[model samples]
Target: MTPPNPQDALRAAAAHVSRRRFFTVTGAAAALAFSVGLPQAHADEPADPGTVRQEPFTLGVASGDPAPDGVVLWTRLAPAAFEPDGGMPPAPFLVDWEVAHDEGFHRVVRRGRELAHPEFHHTVHVEVDGLAPGRPYYYRFRLGPWISPVGRTSTAPPQHARNSAMRFGVVACQNYPGGYYTAFKHLANEDLDAVFHLGDWIYEGAVSATGGSRAYPAGTLPAVFNHETVTLEDYRLRYALYRSDADLRAAQAAHPWILTWDDHEVENNYAGAISQDNLPPDEFLVRRAAAYRAYWENQPLRRPQRPRGADLRLYRRLHYGTLAQFDVLDGRQYRSDQAFGGAWARPGGDADDPARAMLGERQEHWLADGWRDSRARWNIVPQQVVLAERRSEPTEAYTVSMDAWDGYTAARTRFLDAAEAAGVENLVVLTGDVHVHYAMDVKRDYADPGAPAVASEIVATSISSGGNGAERPASYDRLTKANPHLRFYDGRRGYVTVALDREQCRADFRVVPYITTEGAPVATAASYAIEAGRPGLHRV
Candidate 1:
C-alpha cells in the first residue's frame, strides 16, 4: 500500500468546503461563516507589531496540537452570508498575524502575514516554530483596519519531559438548532491546558426534531427532519451558525484543542461503504467532502488538514510529556456497517461474525501498534461515539445510528483484544456522540454478561444536542442494570470535565439545566475514576 499521507485524510476532507464565495469579517458581530487554507500573504496590511488590531476578524481565534517548538494558530475572515454559493461577494485584502510572549505584544516572538480573498474562506493558518515548550502565549490578527481579539494558546512538553500534571476539558456533540453553548462558555473561563473535542461538533444535516422531547423549535418542527446537508453552502451555513455562538468561539480561543470526529459530523451511522441514510459511497463522498472542509476551516487544525477533496483523515496521536499519549481515533471513515437489529438486534452474541468490522483493518492495527508503544502512564483514547459494550434490553429498538461501535461488534472486540495483547497500560476511552452519558466496564465477552471488565469507558453527554433534558426512558435503565460492566448512565444535555493527577484520572459529567436559553446553571450528573495501570473504571 502507498504510504498514507499524514495530511491526505484531512485535505481530502476539506475539499468539501465550498470555496466559491469567501466571506470577510469587517465589523463587530458581522454574521460569521468561513473556511481555511495555507499561508497566503496580502499586500493591503503592512507588517506591524503585536497585540494590535488594524482590521477586525469576527470568527474569533483558536490554536491546536501545541509542540514545544511549534503550535498551530487559526482564524477565519468572515463576511455576512459567507457561503461558496455566491453568498458573500469577494473582496481582496491582506490578513496579518502575530504571536507574542505577553498579551501586550511587548515581547514579539513570531509574526507573519497571509493573503486572503474570496474562494477559500480567507482563513489563514500559521504553524509557528522556535517557541519554548509547555508554555502559554497570546496571539491575534491584523485585518485591514481592525485587529482580531487577542487569544491565548500553549505548547506541549516533549514526550519525555517531566514536570507537573496538566488539565483539559472534554466536549462533543454540540449540534446546532438545539440550544446554546453554555458548556463551552463555562470551560472557556476555566484555566484548562487543552480541550478535547471528541466528535459530533455539528450535526451534518438540517435542524433536528430528533431533539423533539428536548428541542425548542425555531418556528416549526419537521416530522422526520431528514435534514439533508451536502453542498458547500449547507456546510458553511452550519459552521457559521455554530461559531456564531459566543461561548463556542471563546472556548476555541481559550486553549489549544485536539480533535477527532464521530458519525454525526457527516451523518448518523456512516460506515466506510454506506451511510445510515442509505446513500451510495460516491454520493455520500460529495457530502463528506463538504463536511470535512467546513470542519477544518472552522477549527484550529494544522496546515495538514486543509481541503484536498472530500476526505480528511482524522486519526493522529498527541503526546504531552511522559504524562500521556492521546491516540485520537477516526471511527467513521473506515468503520463497518451497523449491526442490523437494535436492542433486539441479537442476544446469542455472535460478535465474532468474522465478517463485521469496526475501526477498519488499518485503524485497528494502528491503534494496537500505538498501544504497544504508548510510553505514558496513562493512554487516553479520545474519540467520537460508543466503544463500551451496550446491553440494551431484548427489544426491537434499533437506532439508525450505525456510526456507533455498538453497530460494529466484531471489529470492536478485535480492537479491544488487540489492546489487551499490546500491554497498553491505563487504557482510558473518552467518547461523545451517544448524546447520553455512560461509564462502562469494557469486557472480553458480552455474551457472558458477567465477563471480566477490561478497559474503562467514559461516555460524555452531548454538549447541547441531547435536546433539552432528554432521557432514554426506564427500559434502557434495565439494560444498564443487566450489564454488570456498565457503571453509570444518564441521558441529559451536558459536557464532561476530566482532571488528571499522578495516580488516577477523574471524569466529571457536567450537565447543564438547559441550552435552549442562555445563562444556564451546571451540575455534575455523575463522575468516574480510573487508577493508573488498572484499565477498569469504578464509580467515584
Candidate 2:
C-alpha cells in the first residue's frame, strides 16, 4: 500500500467523524483488529449494564502543545487501567471538559461536551482556544457528578512579543520497572513554562521481577504475550500502566508537555519500518501501526498529529515570542537503516555516505529553512539521541552507537554547517535517550581538530531507566578527557532544567539521590551557562 499524503490522510480521518453523533468511535469489529486472539477473561467487558458507578478519571488529566491562543486537553476514562479495554463498555459515553483562568474554576473560559468511545479507550482530547497568551490556565473533565483533578497549563507568548523568556524541564527515558518516579515529583514543583519530553515514554519490553532495584508489582502484566508490545492493546496497556503513576500524573497536571518519541515507544532501537530483530518489513509495519495509533490515542497531541496507518505528522515548530523558536523534530520516522547492522563501529565510509540521511531529505530542508527564517533569540532543537561526537574508547579511531547522530556524520555536519552558514548563532540542542547527563559543544566539524564550536547541546539523564546510577561513572573521566568539546558527564537518575533569555541560557543538572524508593530529594549536581553569541558552555 502506498503511503497517504498528509492532507489526504487528514481528510480521510475527518470523514469518519460525525460531530452530530458526538465523534463516533471505530466500531467493535474494527477494534478487533487490535484485540484478535486475546483471552476473553482479559477483555474489557461491556459497561456494567448500568450507569458508571466508579470514577472514570483514575488515569488523571493532561494538556499539551500550547499555542498563543490555546492548548490541547487530554484524559482517558480508565477505571481499570490494567484491563484490555480500560474497563469501559463498548458504547460511547458523554464526557464534559472545561478550561478556566483559575484552579477554583470560578471564572469559566471554555467549556464543552465530547463523547468518549470505547474503541479509542474512552479518551477525550479537547482543543480549547480563544484565551490570553503567555499566561496560566486551569482545566478539568467531568462525567455527571464525577470531576477530574484540575490540571494547570499555559499558552506560549505572543509570537511577536519583544521581551520574553522561557523555562522548560527536559526529561525522557522513564521505564516503569526500572525504579520509582521520585524525580518527577520534584519536576512537578518546578517553575516551568512547559515540559520537553524527548520520547521513551514507556518501554515496550518487559522486565523480570528480580532485575533492578525495584521489583515489578503483581498484576501489572497482562495474561497474553507480555514480553514485548506487538499489538495495539498491548501498547495501550503499557501506556495505561505508566500513566497510573502519581508522580508522572502530577508532572503532567502541573505543566503543558511537548512530547516526542524514541525507540522504546515501539521497540528497542528499531528504525522506521525495520525492527532490530530483523522482522520482515510488512510484519514490522503492522506492529508499528499499532504502536503509533496507541501513542496518538494516549498523548495530548492535536488533530494534525493523528496517526494514519504507520505515519504521523509529529514534527512541527513552536514559538516563544521573540525569545526562542522550538523546532521539535522526529528523528525516527524518516531515516535510513542503521549502518554496520546497528552496532558500534568506526565512524567513516558508509557512516559518512551523504545518502545515509537521518532526518530524511524533506525534514533536513525544513530545518534548514527554519534556520534561515528564524527571528527568535534562540533556535532550540528538542530531539532524541545526542548530537555530539562520542567515542567508546579514548584511543580507538572510531565512534559508538550507530543508532545515534554519530552514525550519520555527513548529515550531522550538513545540519551544523547550514546553521553556521545561515548565521544562526545561539543554537541549543536538547537531547535524551542515552540515560546519562552530557553537556557538550557542537563543533562545526567533529572530524576537524581545530574546528570552532557553533552550538551547545544539553543531554538529559533518564528519569528512572537505569535505576539509581552512581554519581560518577568511568565514562565521565574517559569520554570528557578524550573529547574536549564534552564539558560535563555524569551517570545519575534525574532530569535537566533549562532557563533561556535574550542574554544567556542556564541549564541546571538536577539529580535525584535515589529512585529505588519514593521521596528522594533532588539537587543540582552541576550548573552551566551559554552567553549570547557564545557556542561553548561555561561551568558556573
Best by TM-score: 2
Query: Residue-wise lDDT of candidate 2 within 448-478, one digit each (tens)?
Result: 7678878999999999998789888867777
Q: For model 2, which pairs clash?
A: 47-89
* Model 1: per-residue Cα lDDT at residue 232: 57
Cα RMSD, each candidate: 7.9, 7.2
1-540 per-residue lDDT for model 1 (tens digits): 123333434333442232211111112111121133323554234333232222336668889888778788887766443334223334444677888999999998998876554455666678889888889999998765678888999998877886458888888888766677888888888777898988877776666543433345554443333356666557666666567678889999988999888777677767654657655455556566667777886777876666555557678888888888888888777654554532235422333355555666777788888888877877888887777666565334532233456656567767778887988767788888777788888877766865767788888887888567655645566766566677777777777778786688888887777778778877887778888767677778
* Candidate 1 RMSD computed on C-alpha atoms after optimal superposition onto the true structure: 7.9
How many clashing pairs per prediction, in order?
Answer: 32, 1
Q: Candidate 2: what lDDT?
A: 0.83
Query: What Cα-based lDDT does every candidate model obtain?
Result: 0.69, 0.83
